[model samples]
Target: MTIRDTVIRTLAHTNWRLALPALVLTCGSLIVQAASEDPEVVVPTASPTTAAINPAGVVTPAPGTAADAASGVVKAPIAAVAPPTAPQAPAPVDEPLMKLPVNARHMLVIDDTGRVLMAKDADTVVPIASLTKLMTAMVVLDAGQDMNEEIRIEDADVDRLKHSRSRVRVGATMTREAALELALISSENRAASALARHFPGGLAAYEAAVAAKIRALGLTHTSLADPTGLSPANTSTAAEVARIAAAAARYPAIARISSDKSSAVEINGRPRELRNTNHLVGAKGWDIRLSKTGYTEEAGRCLAMRMKSGGQTITVILLDADGSAQRLRDAAAIRKSLAKIAAA
Candidate 1:
């Protein structure tokens, strides 16, 4: 082996190695150029400008218009809507009747149309006591005399009970209207008897008028022996008393006068404020249109009312209750029953 032969073999090996590296560098340069020319990928330049590219590789605003300098309008993300709040539960109702400590002997409730809603011995006759004054006022109103006419209290008007309350003294003069007001509002026995005595046909015919009115109103279980219910003979049932309340409600004046809780009237030429015996008229929960309360040893405590409850009109009559508290409780019981029925 000479030196020349050794050099030629080495040079050929070196050329083979250089040819492989040159081929790899050419392929890499071509790949990079191709990627740069692709329209989908855009490289940002040094100029203070942004390009808008759609999803499909389309460029907008042609690179130099006002839109190219201004930022694109960004769509705001939608906010999630909140669900509605849950409905609240109804408030609990208190039962006033359940708090009463006494029981009543007879009770009844009727609709404004005279249809019975509830009854407990409603048809059994019981002494009506002072409830007779309701019919007495009805008789006086029917007598066709001027309400402003004056009448003098006589000895007959005074109650035999020495300590009993009275608005009129013997020989004192008061108008018919004032007397009727005192009679209905305060349950004044003297005013009632005075009105009866001054009726067109006097006391006897006045009693007849009361009976006739009871008959005309179709109150079959009612009987009247006196203008004031002081006479134990004046007796009626709860059903009949409810009918009387309905009939009285027909007369606006009677209804207005009966429901008045308090009023000022002249007695013996002085102003006397008369308070109603029926507490339901002035009670907070009652919308009383007509009302009357009665009490006697024979009748106990009695109450009748035309009232609105639970958006419906009703008549309530409580007879021979043990006390005033019991009569009020009876009324509250009927109201509670009606409310329950309405809710159902």
Candidate 2:
């Protein structure tokens, strides 16, 4: 018989409606089973760069997705989602750009525009020793006295307060210019006292002039008890000392005299050579524009310098170091740091 005739004959012996419902259920289950076993079928998953919104109403864009890019959001490329790199190390505590090893108890470094480059305890007041000669020289120069006039180094010029010995003797006489050279170059106490004593109105007038200059320079933290700086009372902060150095640099005579590595002058009618207290003044690779060195029991070793490096003007002040060697090392360290900073 034909297939249609045979199927009709079998259905005639059963309930066709109940059999139709069973057939529909069996077909649905077979289709689901077939789909689960299919090898080529792929189920969609969530994107790795899915957008997320926090409770604070901030929406983080889904990166590396075309939907985000279509909405004007910055989309990172697929190749840009690289594995995180290791963190870099922090700079050392003594980074040259910010800090350096320094031995002085107080220091201040600045540029020509008075912008501070480095500082440590620079605002604290301390005895300045013979750094006072810079002010003394300024006062003497401001008065416009005869630099060629001979000034006798009397007994009053002797260091009674400190009992400090001097190469310029009590009976010795030298020109005011020579005395200034000795005072600044060699830090001669007798020479400084004689310059002040020979002031137009004497030492008292010289003190007044210093006070005026301090006011003029706006150096509130500086005080001068004596022109020679032999008195422990002669004191200033490193910041104020820097201001004094800048003012001294403006005077042609002070700048010229203080920077001299050595000067030949006749003392007691005998010619003698005076060497600069600052050894760096004539040292190789040191472009020192102005330099001064000072020391005392209370002040320790002190140095102030205006230097040029890499076409920049740098002023360095060191105070209360343990010794001259330590002071010079600190200065050298600072110079090296400046060179690095300039190079970078």
Candidate 3:
């Protein structure tokens, strides 16, 4: 049976409630489908010449006709039928695209030479969350501020909670160096704000300097809307963030703080052991020089790092990963791809 008839019959077999609407919609859909399938219609070409008529209205034979002493009566030009079009290769099935977990948005792994090894939506700008502390650390170090100077955490520093995790207590006093360490190792938001406040011209100047530093690093795709990665507005691409991590790794202090799995810091006049959020620091087969872990509702469990793999130095950035485990899997996939390439 014709497709149209088949659809009509199928609709008739359904219950009235569904049948009526189904039939109407199916009819329109079938019409469109059939129209698309119809072959192109070619118009017939004209004959080279036609018979002439005398004044007496008598028909004169054309040059190619038998009466003209050439051939039989002129044949009507045939419409040139296109050889039935070769059946189109069935359109590709359009296999479903891979879907990442909710926590991860963009991820990348790169060689030390800045070659991208593997990436997923790496260029899409999303919040870096607490990863912003890397830039804060860089800016603080760049300012050449006295790390040894003691800085007191004022009530103002503790006032803006922003609901982020912190190791800095409101009344604690600590060395600038220790505070910086706590910020990087523990993702301490309060310490970061205190450092920004202590910048050469205070927080305002610090914010400006962060932008300037991003420009200096040629990170066109990254921006610092806040000292801490607390603001969802603080966004950066995986590539740009990898570069930031690479630069951050050069500082002995940053390396020292980031690689330490745990360190003791005095909080509220009591010693509290703060651990590195990046589990890969001491994990087997990972030579992590510097690393940080970040997560926010807007920015899923994110990580950025510099490490040695297969005797080659590399950097990795994973943003909005599904879970902590998936980030590790993504990193492993990158290493495997690189290994295969190297073997080739």
lDDT of each: 0.71, 0.78, 0.70
Output the better candidate (1/3) by TM-score.
Answer: 1
Count clashing residue pairs per candidate: 0, 0, 6
RMSD (Å) per prediction = 32.9, 22.7, 22.5
- Model 2 residue runs over 4 Å out of place are 1-94
* Predicted candidate 2 versus true structure: per-residue lDDT over 149-227, tens digit per residue: 8889898888888788888767888888889889889899999999999999987888899899888777777889999
Ranking of all predicted structures according to lDDT, beginning with the best and ending with the worst? 2, 1, 3
Score candidate 1 by TM-score against the native: 0.68
Candidate 1 vs candidate 3: the lDDT winner is: 1
lDDT of 3 by residue, 171-215 (tens): 688888878888899888888888898899998999899988887
lDDT, candidate 3, at 32: 78
**TM-scores of the models, in the given order?**
0.68, 0.72, 0.67
Q: What is the lDDT of residue 236 in candidate 1?
A: 85
